[model samples]
Structure formats: structure tokens, C-alpha cells
Target chain A: MKSAFTRNRPLATAVTALVGLPLLLAGCGASSGSAGSENVTEISVMDYYNNEPDKSFIGDALNSCAAEAGVTLKRETVPGKSLISKVLQQSSSKTLPDVLMLDNPDLQQIAATGALAPLSDFKVSTEDFAPGVLSAGTYKDKVYGLAPTVNTIALFYNKDILAKAGVTPPATWDELEAAAAKLTEGDQYGLAFNANPTYEGTWQFLPLMWSNGGDEKNINTPETTQALQLWTDLVKDGSVSSSALNWTQADVNDQFLAGKAAMMVNGPWQIPALSKQPSLQYGVVKIPVREAGQTAVAPLGGEVWTVPQTGNKARQAKAAEIVSCLNSDKNQMSMAKARNTIPSKTSLAETFAKENPKLATFTELVKTARARTGQLGDGWPAQATKIYTAIQAALTGSASPGDALKQAQGQ
Target chain B: MSLAADLSPSKAQSRQHGPAVDQAPLVPRRRNRHRKERLFQWLFLVPAVVYMALFFGYPVVKNVIMSFQDYTTATFFTGEAPWVGVQNYVTVLSSSLFSTSLLNTALFTIGSILGQFVIGLALAIFFQRKFPLNGILRSLLLLPWLLPLIVSSAVWRWILDKDSGALNRFLGDLNIIETGVPWLTSTSLALIAVVGVNIWIGIPFNLTILYGGLQEIPDELYEAGSLDGATGWKAFRYITWPMLKPVVSVVLVLGVVYTLKVLDIILGLTNGGPANSTQTIATQSYALSFQEFKFGEGAALGNVLVIISLVFAVLYLRASRRAVDE
Candidate 1:
């Protein structure tokens, strides 16, 4: 056996060399790509509007804006959830699109990475934009992104169901609880809202938490506990189904459309789907506050367009031009009208609300809507995780609201 | 065929071809021909070895290195991961949720493997009997295995939904239960329900592999056992069990390894939620890396899982070796 192995030593050596050759080659290879050309005729744009109407609406707006700026557009739309992962991959490969759209809350996190150029770098004005929307796009006092339109969650109730139950639109937490209980019937709950273990859950809870004077920076306070207690009481009262722990915002909307839920807390994005059900008469109102006089403070929900640092001066300037033009007064109104969202600029709010009365509540809410990252900045992601974790723990009855908050914060 | 002949290739060749091809002047040519034959034999194995190295070995090594470094969202852009020297491991091991996750993983794997093996073995043995349409029925049993895990998870999610689930509806119709059972919503029951769904998904794979193993054991052993007053339980213990030990170990080890890293089913069903009753190490690792963006801690936890799998693999290999030797 020893003699045979000695005889095959040369063959073994050759095989070993062959196996190592590819690994060495793989290590030496560098993945790089050149930026869009200086004399750019067409600039690449990336956004998360892969769904139907928003896809076409954003496409038309981009085409019009590109024409206004004297350039053609190359568009790439990904699913809403995967937009951040795609941006990270593109950022690392130095292949970030010239123009990119980010969910408002994520803008601060991405901007902190220095992958986005400040709008002021290309002489784009941030003046007259809603304070909340501007705060969402700003990092360290520099505005890195701008939005044409924005949205926020609100109380959407079935008009037919409310009339049948002899219940009015709830204006306070007590009224909401009573109304939800009154509407509860066989196979149907009085209320539906997402409290799933995701950022969306945290987003939905912001209205209650902010209205009750809860702050994300210090989540385990009395105000936050009271907000969580409201959710727990609803679920405990059997007005909100135990399955709200698993439902997404879309799932909540489905429950409402099916008449399994008399009311749902959702955003204007559900309007198109709601319109598809012609017989379902739904009316929109602000999410209930903890008290009658308290203002309903919903978290702002929108996508902001920005120019990424693509290492090409001419293309960056042109990308900025398209970004600015997409947010111009005329384009903002048109895009907001096309999509079921409110204009981000305060100047355009009155006109947009007058034009699209269905979105008036959202428009009014947008004025007081707070950016999720307003306090935490880049730290918002961690806080959001804690918020959702606590919500899940409290709703599941595994921990009290206070204990859940403590556990969620890793104390 | 002899060891001496193999060591001395020229002697074997001369004996085979009548000593004519072993000429002294043509010795270099003969050596070149032998080397070419060995190279061709090696060429067949090179592709498989290269694939394993690239796909499996590289990732394992990369994960270990990442576990020791502070790999985060910034690392993807800056390409700078500061080495933290086991701090990630410390954090993972010391976290309060670690114990809960470790216990959950053990229960999930053991529960799934035990349920699948017992039911699968029973079906495999039952299918061994000759019957009409037996072949067709056995082939159809593999359909569950063929379906993607995510599809199974989604179907199970609807079936186990609290208010309007089919399971509750069926039970309610029979007056077996008044209200719906909170299968995925309650902390105490979610883990068991998840394990039950996983067992259903795993049954087909175990049954097919065990059935193949059973067929390899000749009928003569059973006949011999029956002659010696061994039948049914006695026959299986004295004959089938000993012969099927190797295959059983393989099934169990593979099942444990696969179960240890299950992510999608848990994510789709409970998302490691309802107060984290279903939070296993694999799902928690995913949450850390993707949800919390803490890749280093995720890698640390992943390495822990790999070590656990390696332990089971080593024990099974040793047991199999002893079984072969005996």
C-alpha cells in the first residue's frame, strides 16, 4: 500500500494544484463597474413601486419629469419590502442607481452611510416641504432626500357596518373600545389592525403611542404602557381577534373587506383595493386619541426620491434635476392625485386635499404626522424592533405590558 | 489482483500482455501511459470535490471568520470588519433568550425526528406486504416530500388559523370543542403545533429512504427468524432491527441535521412569535442577521448550531462503525 501511494504522489500533487487554482483566481478577481457616463442621455432610476397602479403612476411621473429635464429614464422597480436590501447590495458594488427612492424612515439610516448626496449639493431646495417629511429625509442637518407625496395611517371603518350597529366614528380610546365591542358579532371582530412582529406593527402603534404622549426614545414609560394596555384590552375583550398577532396591514384590509372586521387602522394605500369592492362603503377618519382633546399623532409613511453618490458629476447633476422636478408643485399634485397619497409640500396640501377629498383626513394627519426617525435618527431600526417585540409579548399574554417593554429592551 | 503485483505495475502489465510491452527501450512510454490512466481516473472525482469546497467549505470558513468580527450593515459598504475576538460568542451565549432557544431547538428536533421515524418505519414495514395497488400507493406517499416547504407552511398556516381554521371548523361541527383552539397564537401550544406540521412534512422523506433500506434486506433472514420461533415483534428485534441499524442511523443523523437548521416553516407559521414559543436557534439567527442587522451575532449563533450538528454526526459515525465491525 505504501509503495502504491508513493507511485501516485505526482498525480495527487497535480490534482491538488488544479483544485487550488480556481480558488486563487476567485480571490484575485475584483467586481467593479463604471458610473453612468458624463454626457448622460439616460439615467437609471430605482424605486419600490412594482405593484400595479403605483407602478404605472410612478412610471408616468418619471417619464414626464425626465422629459422636463431633457433626459430619458431607465427605471427599475423592486418590491416594497426588498428595496433596502437591493440598495445595500448596489451601494457595496458601487453600482447604485443615479436616482433612488427610499421609504421615509429608512432614508435617515441610508443617508448616514454616506451613500446618498444631499439635495442641496445639486441646488435643490428643501423649502416648503412638510416638517415631518423633511425631518425623515435629513441626516445631521443635511437634507439627503425629498418626497413628492406622503401618507399616514388612519381609522377606516365600514359605513354600512357602523350604520347597522348604530355606532358613530370613534374619537377617543374609550369610545373606540365601546364601539368595537358593540360591533362584535358571530365570526366577525369589531376591530382589525396589524400587531405582527415587524416594523409595520410598530408603525401602526405609533398613532396610539404618540397620541398618548409615548416617546420612542424612552419606551418603557407610563404613556407607552397605557398605549399598549389599550391594544391588550381590545384583544382581551374579544373585539380584536387573537389572530391580529399574525396579520399584516394587507391582511387587516382583507379582513375589513370580507366584513370580518367592522373597522381597520390602515393607510391610504388600501384605497385602490377598497375601491375594487364597490359595495363596501368605507369612510376614513383619524385614529382615535387617548382623550377627546388630544391630537392624533400618526407616523408619516411615504417614499422619498434622492440622488445617490454614483461618482459621476454630470449624471449626479442630472439625477438631482429629475429628483427636484419630480417634487415640483405641478408634478407633486399630479403624483399625489395619481397615487392615493398627500402632497409632501405644505404649500400643495390645501390644493391636494381640495382635489382629492377622499384623502383629506390623511392630508390633515400629515401636518401633525411625526417622522419615526425624528428622535432616534439611525437608531430607529433598533427602537422599532423593541416596539414590535414588546407589542407581541403584551398581546400574547406572555408578559404584562410593563414587563414586555422591559424584556424587549433587553433589560 | 495481488498487492505485490499492484505495487509493481510493470510486473502486472507484463503478466497481462505477455511481457512484450515491458521492453527496456520503451520504459518511459510505458510509465507515461500508466500516469495518463491514473490522471483520467482522478479527473472523474475533481468536479465533485471542487463543488463541495466552493459551495460548502468556503461558506463554513467564512461564517466562522465573520463570527469573530463585527460584521454589520456598515461592513458591507466599508469592507472593514473589526475583529472582536469571541465577544459575539459571549453575547450570544449570555443572552437570556439563548437558553430558551437552545431548549426549543432540542425539543423541535427530537420531537420531529421521533414522530417521523416511528410513523415512517411503521408505514415502510406495512408497505413491504404484497397487496393490490401497493406500488402506486407507495409512490403517491412521496408527494408531500415533493412539495416545497414554504407551500406546506402556508397551507398549515391557514389550516391552523384561530377563528376560521378548517381544523377548528371540523372540530366544532362534531361538537368536540366549543371555541377555536389557538394553535399558532398561544405560547404553550405553538411549538407543539409547529412540530406536528414539521413531522407531516418529514414523513414522506423518512418513509422512502427506510423503504429502500428494507428492500435491501433479503427475505431469507425473516424466513430464518420465523423458523426459530421469531415473528412480528420478535422477528423484527432479532432479524430486521440488527440488519437495518446502519440505515436507521443515517436517517436519524440526516433528520437531526435538517431539523436543526429549519427556518422557513417556523418563520411562515409563527415567525418565532406568539411570545417566542417557537424561537429556535436557526430562526433567531435569521432574525439577528436580517431583522436586527447584527450579522456577527447571527454568525456566532450559527456556529453554535454547526458545532451541535457536528457532535451528532461524530457520534453517529462512531456508532455506525461499531455496528459494521460487530
Candidate 2:
């Protein structure tokens, strides 16, 4: 946990991989003679990753890895949640793909249930991966997944809206409140925030909690209560709409594009969607602090590839190989560039900026991203929903935030 | 169940006539119904029964078990669920919200059924007159019912919007009232608005069914009444009412069952909101199960709703049988 706050020195290994990505990819092609009887085995991977251009960018890297390893790669696209459900369903029927992409697969409980195959068993080295990335996919100190990209949350704002309001993006809690209030007018809201009354409603809340030095599952504490208080204050002051309760991030995005909202706290996944609205000019900013003098610390969330235990050892081995190759620097770089995703390796952040300069601003913000506060466990799922929904009720004037926080903490 | 069956020829009769009817000795007894046939019967039923057992039955049973145990959908997805017995249900009951939600659901059901039945019966009677444009108007009447629930709910939500709602704007333009009422946003008014919308959607169904029932009543009886100097309201009450009784009873009971179980309408309408005042049992049950993953508590809620519907169904059947006998 502490290693996360510390650098942990991944710079040297990442730089090496970045320089070698192209050369290693080149060596993948035109193998013959002494290459032995091993032929390139092509496997398809399906994920909700990026649009066509970014998909092709990542596709190119996957192809390069296949060539280098005498293996071929094919890809399929699906929404992340749908893809994960498909994989889980396939486990019962033994109809799994060679490789899969999942977000917050939370394989620890799955691994504990003997679903995921341990990575150590496959002889894969984990030294190059980020601490949290590997740890999130591990169970009882055994790796179950290899994440190609690291996705984090950040504050997204309309540059035109801010400029017209004669305000810069707020750096601190008080400043955020003042700026948001100033930006508010009839039919134009200051902040488009998540008001979804669900456990997962913690997206905006978590960052606020962290900035206040609070953790999840302990929401009744002073720091957590302060975080909840921030939202309650906004709602009560009419800076935020009470009707935003139980809304998805897409709902917030819709409001922003319609020119009804000035600023909203969303995520990296929303960048492409925002970019698609050519008429709307916006930029990504680090989340504003809700604490006395702290910087915003938005939590990171992304997908990981994991192999599961099954009757067919041959298929399982092949799947493991596919996971390993897909995690290569070439594919990671392509994904980073194409999808605006931060690869688990810090080096790809530079590649992403070089490939797509527009995303450089967001890539820079990745340095200070924090993981969500709470153990990724089974107990947290429904409890989180109850807590968030109650928070919504509190914010919407049905209950007080203090009472809501108390209920959540009790749960 | 026994009354509803389409009875096949009796096996006992065939057995009794077997000695005299059978010609082939080598074929033996009951050639058409062999042990293999019995095995095949089990086999045919297996796939459908197994499918239900796994997907529906198991989940229902599991849900009941889970309501007793503190379970979450996310935790269930990860596959290691620790049991905390009856805590979730006790908590749900003790929360002070469930009782009010249950009352809301009952009120909604009663209000919706009464409005839909009365209005629908009126439409059915009007359409029975065979007017010049009856066919066109009958088809047009189904517009609300034809639209999907969620889509219509969203449209209604906009129309009920406090600021930009079309209904409010039109009412203001017409000066129907001094000011607009917060149709959906108001805690006290949301439930009434939802029930009103639901009744509107339900009218076509009642009209169609009652219209069909009106057809089955002979014109001869009405003609005889007219010849005997029986006039409009009196003749209609004595002659038309008796025939329509069966159909009205069915509609009333079915409406009770359906309206009681209404969730999507409530979910799409106000999402049981403004506060707990508009909340319903069906919505709470779904929210408890899928959204909260408290399957057990959800199941308990569901079971209560199911029992409510089942009681109405049984009552309808009993009344129908008594009506037939009388």
C-alpha cells in the first residue's frame, strides 16, 4: 500500500520496454528454419476498449507481438461489463475465449473460489507491472490478471463555459464552491455530479473522501462525513440539481453537451465521447480539492486479463500465452495512444502524448491518481450501493447527510 | 387446474376393452404406451424442467435463502458468499420505509384498477354502438398502450417536468389554473400522477376485452326487450348487465393482479421519488434484489406480492364458478 505513494522505481524497466517495443515487434515477423516446429498461434481478444482508430492502433501491436512470439492475434469488441459477464457465464459451460478483457474483474474472490488460474503456475514474471495493477488481480499472493492499461478518474470541464464565467478551474474546496456557484445561472448548472443513489455512486464521493483523508466502509468518520457534507452543501445551496440523484455518468455528459452544465467530475473513458461533440470545447483538469489545502486524488479503475481453471489444460496454457503476449509493450503503447488510456507502464504515457497530443494534459494527471479506498471484496458490492443510494436520499433532502453517513457506516 | 384441462380419451376405458379389441398377440399389451415411452416422456420434460430448475427455480429458492442471509450481487459474482442470517430482512423491515412503500403500492393498485375499469367499460359501450368512424377511433385509442412502457414513462416524465413540461405549459397558456402543480416532483402528488398515467395506458385493454364480451351477448335479447316496451336504461341494466357480469369480473380480478405487480410504470415514472411517499413494494423488491443484491429480502418482498396476486386469482376463480352455477 505504501509503495503506491512512493515511486517504487518502474522508470528503468518501462524505458527499456518503450525503446524495445518496435524492435521486438519487428523481430516477430518472417521467422523460418531454426524457429523450430512452433507456428504462430492466433487468438482473438474481445473488450470495450476504444474507437476504430485506437482499436487499429492497438491491433497493430497485437499483430506485432504475435509475429515476435510466432503467435497471431485477433480482436473483438464489447462493452466491458457485458464482456465480463460473458466470461463468467462461459466458466460454467467451458466456452471461454483464449483471452478476455475485464474492468475491476475483482478476481480475488473469484480466485479464492478457484475460478482464476494462478499466474505463478504459468511462470510469468510480474516485476515490470505496477504494484496495484498486479495486486488488484491477485489472490492470496498469486497473480490472476495482467492489465494493459490503467484508467483513472478526473474532473472534466468545458473550457468555453469556464472562460465565459470568468473563472479558472478551482484548485481547492472553497474555490471550487465559489467557482461553481458563480457559473450557475438559469438552465445552466455549475456542477454536473453523480447523484445516483447506488453503492457504485462513490465515484465522485471517493475522490472527495480521499482529498479529505477518508476511506470507504468507514464513512461515518469526520473525514468521510466532511466529504458527504460537501455534496449536501452543494445541493442545499442550489449549485447542484437535486434531480441528479441516481443518474449515470452518461446522464451528466448529456447535460454538459446540451449546454446545461459548466463542470462535471467524470472519467478518462468519457474523453472520446466528449471529443465526439465537435461543437463543445472542453478540457480535462485534475479534480478539485474538497479539503482545506489538499490536491484532488481521483481513483484509478481499468480492465485486466485473467485465465481461469478448466478441464482442458491445453486451452488454459494457450490462454495464458495469449494474456502474456497481449500485455507486451507494443500492444500497451498502441492502446495508450489509441484509447487515451494510461498503460500500466509509465513509459507509455509519453508514447500516448507523442501519438495524440490532445490527451497529453490528461496523461500528465495520471501521476497522482489514487486507487479507490476499500478492499476489493465481495462484502463491499451491495453495501456500497446501499450507502450511495442513501447518500442520494440525504443529498436530495429526504434525509440528512449525517444520518445517511451513519446508516452507511452501520451497514 | 383440473377444470382448465383438455381431457384426452381415458386410459381405463382402453384397458377395459383391450381383451376384445386387440388383434396382434406378439405386439402384447399397451403397445402404444411402453416403458420406453414413459422414459421418453421424462426425457422430453427434462430439458424444460431442468432449464427452469437451474435458471428460475434455483434463483427463486436461492433468493429466499439469501434474504435470510446478508448477500450482495457483487459478492455473489465473486463466488464466496458469507451468510448472515435474517439480518437483511430484519433491517429492511425495521427501516420504517417499507411499510409506507407497501401502502403506496396498495393505493396505486386500487386507484389504477378503478379508473381503468370504469373508463374502459365506458369506451367499450361507446364502441359497441357501431358509429361511422368506430374502427378508426378504436385503433387510435390504443396509442398510449401501444407505446413501450419505459419510452412512454420518459415522455411522461418530461411532460410532468416542473419547468419545461408541455402539460403544465399548456395548462398555463389556457389559464386552467393560477399556477402549475408539480405533477411528478411533488411527494404528495407523484403517486396519483403515476396511477393516472397507468390507467390511461390500461384503458385500451379493458375496452377490447369488454367489447368482445359485448359481441357474445345476442342482439335477439335486446330486440325482445325493445318489443316489450323496455326502455334504454332499464332494459340495458336487466338484459345487458347479466351477460357482461362474467367479463367484468374477469377484468376486475385480472386488473387487480396486474396493477398490484406494477413496477416498470413506477420505476420509469418517478422512481418512487421526491421522497419515500411514492415508493411501491414492487419497485422496492426489484431495487432490493438486482440493484442491492439483497436477493433474500427482495424475494420476501416478491413472495408477498405473489401471494397477493395469487389470492386475487383464486378469488376470481371461485366467483366465476359460483356465477356459472347460479
Candidate 3:
């Protein structure tokens, strides 16, 4: 009996390995559709719209576009931060999805890698889009992606608190400081903004920096030093919370909603959530410029849809069709209305603003907003890192504004 | 044990002396049977060996190869990572942030281990006493370690917030101090606060392991020591310390290895921020690879960290071998 059992065990194990290894190896092959499948049935798509309102809104648009293009959509979503990492991993494995969504600023970086198919090759029209938004999705003068709607940071104030404190929305640097100080009372800070050690921090600082004539290429100049000093003075005077060094844009909105901050610098994405708060009355305006008459050149915020190079020509062309369909004026207007952002097409901006009165301020702000990658292209990441590092050093008192800028700029 | 004995004819010869014919026919059959048994036993180990080879060995080999190449984001799409021959190592070592990250790594590991060990040992000894609801209370102490590290970090972020945090609010309510301490926002205080939270997370792990060791030391030793006038502090000095040496070495060595690679806690809390005061080698390597897309330089830094850990692991194995021999 024992001999029978022992003999059967080895034979059983050998049989299992014989069947399993081949199956596992077969499962590990390339993931995307074949290059020349004649019947082009379904196209896989991926994006970072993992959060609510966006998750469903983007899903609805993608489904509608896939129907228009005569194909089915296979969808994948990841958190906003992990999208690039996922793309790189997929690209290396040759398993990239047909359609990919990239945050606008990240488009140049990925496009420079030659992993994306230029939309011009597919004859997708890139006309009539906002100049800055189009530039963000372009690399080497070839359009790689296009955003349906775009956004930028602006000043959001608690209307009730500002009314009770008798302070109008500040329009320039000096007025901002005075109003912030006068409103500071009890547990609330007068103003709040993100200075966290990330690209978001660099994004928030851009309006202040660009409005004062500071450029990313020349961060150590007097123009930049004055911008850094403005933030430093606020931290020093205690009008802004010292905790801004650790706060993300979401945390700033949290403080604003909690009555712990009278005003915050944020974007229009917070409008839906702000309106959800029944008792919370808020108003929006352009980010205060360094001086009156200066343009408030906020950093542009949005995501762009692109066709990844999956080596499937038919599928690639179809993916570009879906991309264009997603960016159509009709789809752009509807998505903007649903998501509370401004349409990327300049012609649609007037109608979008009139229809969504609450977001009129943002519609005007998006026209003059600057693309982070416009000057540096793929090189913007390293510069953005230095900008935030300088901001943190100055805010924490580890270095003075000029010294911090010099050290961070390595000049 | 039987397999080893069966393989050695010398061991069998010393056990029996018999006539040639009595052993001949049986010897050949017995040898065939033993060989079959041996092959069967090895079949059980094959799956685990293959798993470790695929998951662990492949990544280590890939990382070593990548460290020698000029790997970047472009390499992912083009598959054109050229051999650079130590250029990545030079770049990583030459950077000014290298020394700062190295020092921070050492400070963080030492601070977390020391605080965790001392507090954990004290808790273990206290819990050894016979008390009401002792088992339930001791088990509940593991809640912090049981929670995911990210959850603990998020909660701690709120608790340590300078203005509206629970810690500062409590302090203010008690009139302990007028100004709230900038726990996470200040460069000087951020490292200390990070270490404090890490210690809190680590204490439960150390407590459970050390408490198991304490349980294994028979009570008769303490009873005999008390009779010999070795009571209380002397009992702990002469008996507990000597008996607990093996567990102590294990806890400390494992603590060092684990703490040296801690990333999520620091990333969640401050993201190595407030002027990079809390940046460690592990976090710096992550920033290089994931954030900056300099995969080659990141792999070089990771290999440096692995070399440090390997030295400790080798010393630990040698010490443990000697302990077993004694």
C-alpha cells in the first residue's frame, strides 16, 4: 500500500509540472491586440480618473466615443500619482493600451520617450485649442495629445467670513498682506496655500512667480527672489500657517472648508465639492498679482488623451479617432459642465462660461495660464523639483530666500 | 537524517559485519529503493526553489545588470540601455545629497531601534507578571502594528498637525504652551517626530517577539536565583540578561535590517520634506528611480544599501552559528 502511494505521488507531481509550466509561460506573452487584426473590435484604454465624478464622467465620455468610432472600450484606472509608473511598466512589457491619458504637463516627458504616436500621423485635427493647453500636449511641434477641458489655480474665499471681517478680495501683493493680517483671529489663519515638497507646490507657486516676471529658466534672478521673499514674508508674519510646508492643495481646501482658513489658493476642481457643503458660501477670483495691471499667469491644470505606440497600425488609428472624438466641441462642453472645468477650445469658452456662471472666473483665468512644459519640455521635471525645494527651504527658515534660490538653482 | 545515513556505506559498515552472500542480493534492491525515496523527497523542495529563483533571484540579478547600464525612461521604450561601466555609481556617490542621506539613514535606524528595543523590553517584562485580564491587555497592544503603516501615518499626520492637530489642541487646552509646536513642518523637529512615530509602530513587533523569548526561559531558574540571594535587579542581571542574549541579538539585527529600508512611513508623513531633513538612502533611491526616472543611479544606490545589509546578515549568521555550537 505504501509503495503504491509513493509511486503515484511522483507521477502525479511530474504530470502537474508538465501541464502547468507551459500554461504559465503562455500566459506571460504580450498583452495588446495583434498589429493587423482585420476586424478591429475592441480598444483598451487607461487613465488616472480613479476618483469619483471623474471616474464616471470620463467613463461615460469614453463609452460614447467608442460607440462613435465603431469599437468597444476596455478600461483601466489607477490613482493619479501612479499613472506614469504604470505606463512605463506597460511600455517595457510591450503591453501598452491603445488609448492613454496623461496629465498635460507629463505629455512632453512621455512623448519625448517615443512611446506615443503623434496625432498628426493619424490626421487628427489639433486646431482651435487654447495655445497653452495645446503646447503642453505638444513636443517638437507635433501634437501628441489634446485635453477636452483645462483649469488653473485661483483665489477662493469664504464669503461669510470675509463679509463678517469686512475685507474685499485682495487684488495685489500689498493689499493681500494687509487683508490677511486684519482677518487673522481666533483659531483661523488669514490665508493658506500649498508649499509641499512636490510638483503641486511648484504649480501653486507658478502664478506668483510668473506674475512677477520670474521664469523657470532663471529662478535665481532678482525677479524670482522677490517672488520667494513674498512667500517668506507671509510665513514670517504668521498670516499664512507654517503648516503650508506640508499641506497639499486638498489640505488647503480642507482648512478653508473647516473655517480654519479665511481664504486659500486653489483651482476650480474644488467647486463641485464646495457646492456640496450646504452651509458653506464661497467665491472665486484670479490669483492676486504682484502688482495691479499685471497678468495672473497661473499654471495650467488638466489631462490629455493620447494614442500609445502599440505597434498595431489599425488599432492606433482607431485610438486616435476616439481621442479626437473625446475632444469634440460637444463632448468638451458636456465634460466641462459635468466636471466644472473650462473647455480647452477657445471658441467654446464663451458659451461654456455663459452656461456655467459659477465658473466664469476660471474660464477667464484659463486664457492667460501658462503651460509648465512650454519652456522646458521634458526638462520641466528637474526644474520643478528645484523650485519646490527652494520654496520648502525658505519657508522652513533653513535658508533665506536669495540663498535658497541660489542653492536650489545651483548657480 | 535517514537519507544521510542511507547514502554513506562507511556508516553502515561500522554498524554491521556480515557474510558476503547475506548482504549481496539485499544490498542492490535496498540501494534502488533508497535512491527512489531520495528522488521523491527532493521533488517536494522543487516548487519552493523555483519560486525563490523566479521572484527573488531574478530581481537581484536584473538590478545588478541595470546598475551597470545607463538606464532611463527612454530605455523603457527603445530597449537601448548602453553599458556605462560604473558611471552611475560615480554620479550617485559624488552628489552632495549622498552624505546627508547616508547620515540620516544611520540616525534613523539607530534612533528607531534603540527606542523600540528599550520600550518594548520594558513592556514585555511588565506583561510577564500575573495580573487580571493580562492576556487581553497584552494582545491589544499589538493594534498599532496590526494597522497598515499608511493608515497609522495618515492618523499621525492629523495628530501631529501644528495648528489644529490633536496633540497641539490638547496642549493648548491644558495651557502647557501658548504656541503650537511645528512637529512636521520644521526641519529640525521633523526627523525627531518621524522617529517617534516609527518607534511607536515598531514597539509592538519587538514586544511580541521578546515576550515569546521570555516565556521560553523556565521559571525554575529565577526561583533558584532567588534562593541564591539573586533577587530583583540581580536576578535580571545574572539570569534574565544571560538567558535573553540570543533573542536580543535576533531582535536587534532584524530591527536594523527592517528599519534601514523603511520608506512608506516617511513618504506618507513628510515625503522626505522640510528641506529633505528626513531623507534616507531608501527614500532617496525611490526619489531617484520613481520621481526622477534615473533608474541606473537608483539601482546603484540600492545596491549600496544591500551591501550594508549583507554585511550585518553575514555577521549575524556567524554569531548565531557560534552560539549553537556552544
Q: Which candidate's DockQ is highest?
A: 3
Off by more than 4 A, model 3 = A7-11, A14-19, A33-35, B1-45
Ranking by TM-score: 3, 1, 2
TM-score, predicted candidate 3 vs. hidden true structure: 0.94
For model 1, what is the alpha-carbon lDDT of residue B103?
97
Top candidate on TM-score is 3
Which regions in candidate 2 have their CA more than 4 angstroms from the true location? A1-88, A128-132, A350-357, A373-376, B2-97, B143-150, B153-197, B220-242, B260-301, B319-326
lDDT of each: 0.88, 0.69, 0.89
Candidate 1's C-alpha runs over 4 A off are A1-37, B1-50, B319-326
Of candidates 3 and 1, the better by DockQ:
3
Per-residue alpha-carbon lDDT of model 2 for B225-297, expressed as tens digits? 9899876887668887888988889888988988888888878776666555577888888877655446667
**lDDT, candidate 3, at A278:** 81
For candidate 1, the chain B TM-score comes to 0.87
i-RMSD values for every candidate model = 4.3, 17.7, 3.2
Q: What's model 1's overall lDDT?
A: 0.88
- Report the lDDT of model 2 for residue A362: 58
lDDT of 1 by residue, B27-127 (tens): 77767866665554455345545666777889999999999999877776667789999999999999888998999999999999999999999999999
The residue-by-residue lDDT of candidate 2 on A1-411, one tens digit each, is 433322222333334545665675577453312222234355556566556765676567666655665666667777644554565555544444556655653455445555668777787656666555666676666777777777766667889989988999887778878988998898788987876544346666777887778766567777877777888888677777655663567767777878877988777667777878898988777777765467666666777787766544554566677678767787777676566677776656676767766666556655555544226454555656555755666775666777777765665
TM-score of each: 0.91, 0.78, 0.94
